[model samples]
Target: MLHSLDADLAVIDPEYQLRRAARVDNELIYLTRTGGGGARFARRIRRAREEVRTVCGVCGRPGIPRTRSRTVLCDLHWHPLTAVEKAFALSADIPEAWFTDEAEIKNDAYVARSAADQRKESANHLSERDMADLLGVTVQRVHEMFEQELLAGANHDGRVVYPRWQVMEGGRLLPHLPVVLRAADGIEARTLQAIMENVDEDLEGATPAQWLAHGGCVEPVLQTLDQWWWI
Candidate 1:
């Protein structure tokens, strides 16, 4: 019966068998004997069906879905898998055990560290009202300073907080604050704070904030900030 079918197919198309057997020669031969191909063709069909059914959970586009446990991501999001994992970990409702890869574990660790740093920064910061009271001005004035870019404030859990290092006990902003803010515009708040708070060897291990408090020259700090800001 198989030979009769092959003879008829050959009459219709001389290269029919060759074309059918182009890649899956063994499967084609198996199909000729069993009237169907076996595991190889079965697997291929299953994969094809999955490709057709799957869609990206994020963007709703249809494609091959790569899974990380319960999370289904398409190729676009999968390429930056670590960043996706980090974002998930940072979410308030995420489970602690969702991380599956070593890279994800590392990202979770980094996120934890960042959260801790933010908490510390928040603890050391002053609210707008508190800053206004300290500076003997209205809260509206403090907001004006932020809007004018004379002082930098960071959003913490939806509230804007000003770092303590930017203000002195006498309610005066650091003289170099404007220069640093202008030079480091568009930089992350945490990064800008780190730059201002880091101890400089040139200043005998005094942080830029402390050096400025002691009336150190703003030129050196501005020069150093310009060098590091681009990097």
Candidate 2:
């Protein structure tokens, strides 16, 4: 026998055992009771596991439970040392265990290395193409970044739109950068394409989000303004 779905588009069997469920907006208004809640619970657990699989930004690996604490370290790159470990490290007699777990030393090195890289990258001036190249997303996507108001920009009608200086000034609230950069530079399509190529030369392959996150160009723009407050 065939069964018809409701106007709400909820599917269910003859017994209404919740075979399906749906949500509108934030509300779960439709539920089909075909089998049982066990199936739903199982699905929920699967989703939870998938969510946990996300990698931590600091460590570049899947998040995992750590021996130092009960809290899972799947996404936490900097695992705070326990009081015992802290005291041991600070003590005149350092524990040999601290040296044995090369992982702890590795974390410190990661932080130092990342900081140095950031400093070096921040010193460089970004051309239009340099900005475009690293962000693997298209020029249109770059424009969307501006539309989203992530970055402030100044109009250069006859010229290129440039990002506003405020984006990186005094380490202030960094708005979404595209809007600001586009406005400041009044950039054209070709200039953006050039940027993409320049970035590819250095990064090999990079995503738009990665380019934005690197945040070197923004800081330099702000620093340049320090000389001329007349604007």
Top candidate (lDDT): 1
Instruction: Give TM per candidate.
Output: 0.50, 0.24
**Model 1: how far residue 46 lies from native, Å:** 39
Over 4 Å off in model 1, which ranges? 1-118, 229-231
Model 2 lDDT, residue 143, Cα:
57
lDDT, candidate 2, 121-213, per-residue tens: 333333234334544556566456556655333233233342323223333434444443454353333233223222231233542223444
Q: Candidate 1, which ten residues in sequence have the lowest lDDT sum?
A: 19-28
lDDT of 1: 0.58
Q: Provide the overall lDDT of each model, using Cα atoms, as 2-decimal numbers.
A: 0.58, 0.37
Distance from true position, residue 37, model 2, in Å? 37
Error of 2 at 170 (Å): 28
Residue 115 lDDT in model 2? 53
